[model samples]
Target chain A: MFLIVGIFIIIGLGFNLLGAFSLYRFPDVYTRLHGATKCTTFGTLFTMFAVVAYSLGRLVSTGEARFAVFIIHGAVAALVLLITNATGAHAIARAAHRSGTLPARAVVDRLEEKEEAKGGTPR
Target chain B: MTIYIFLFAAALVGLLAVAVLGRLVAGPTIADRAVALDTMNTLVVGLMMILAAVYDSVVMVDIAIVYAGLSFVGTMFIARFIEGEV
Candidate 1:
């Protein structure tokens, strides 16, 4: 039980750390959003999984109902994180684009091109 | 032993959140700062969930859920502000 829980925690911390580092490593907003959003979401998912696993192990060993409550609540928090993180990222990206922040060193900007094709001025 | 692991993980995650703050302070553009803030919010949620396990409190997990929802709304408002819609 300790090994399973430990592995999940380590994996989560690793990814979370990577996400933080990416904020400094990426040069622009869009790229940073890509790294920070995806990595942190994945890391948090693993952390939640670890918590659920721990609760399940305890529930099985001690037959406690509180551990079941822990499991369900932890799962709900994870679901909320998963859904909100993605939507927030999309909102941020769209806002950034509309607010006149262009991607740094891009080969092609399909969104800008598409907007131009529709006769809308690219910001 | 198990408690030590949870505590250590929580501490490390908190450290990562602080590290992300560097970008929040130094980001050259509003969009960059917004992205950093969003990342920090996610980290905080993760930290709350871990702390819930450390303290053996289901109520902490419930708080995490509420915090996540509130932060999402805050992020949306920031996004709208950036778009000049508000």
Candidate 2:
């Protein structure tokens, strides 16, 4: 049980570090957001999983209903993290583009064209 | 002994958060800093969960839930400001 906990945490930490390093190394804001958001979200998934496992293990060993609260709450927190991270990423991406943070290798810009066609002025 | 390991892992995450802070400080654009700050908030929740496990406290996990929600609001507000929607 404890070993599973350790493995999840170590994996989570690795992903977490990768995202942070990618933020520093990525060439531009959009690319950095891509790297940071994906890696960190995945990393948070594992860390939260570790918490779930810990709570379950405690429940099994201690045979108490109190530990069940940890299980449910930890799972809920993970679900909340997953949902909010995606929404926040989209919000950031849209805001970045609107604020004129263009990608480096700009070959296609269908969204910009579509937005302009809608007569929405860039603020 | 197991709790100590969890403590060590949480401490390691805290150190990583500090390292990521360098990016927040050095990010060239507001968006870059915002992205880094958002990632750091996610990591803070992870840290809080690890501590909850170490301390064997259900309330800490509940706190993590609230923390996640508050941070999400903060990130959205920053994104809204960056979009010039404010």
On TM-score, the candidate that comes out on top is: 1
Off by over 4 Å in 1: A118-123
lDDT of 2 by residue, B9-49 (tens): 79888987888998899888898889989989988999999
Candidate 2 per-residue C-alpha lDDT over A3-119 given as tens digits, one digit per residue, 9 for 90 to 100 = 998899889989998988898888988888888889988987898888788778889999999889888898899999999989998999989998987787878988888878899
Pairs in steric clash, model 1: none
C-alpha lDDT (0 to 100) for residue A6 of candidate 1: 98
Instruction: List, residue by residue over A7-61, the lDDT tens digit for candidate 1.
Output: 9999999999999999999889999999999999999999899989989998999
Clashing pairs in 2: none
TM-scores of the candidates in the order shown: 0.96, 0.93
Best by DockQ: 1
Correct interface contacts retained, every candidate: 0.87, 0.78
For model 1, the DockQ equals 0.90
lDDT of 2 at A65: 96
Best by lDDT: 1
Instruction: Please tell me how candidate 1 rates in CAPRI terms.
Output: high
Q: Would you give me the overall lDDT of model 2? A: 0.88
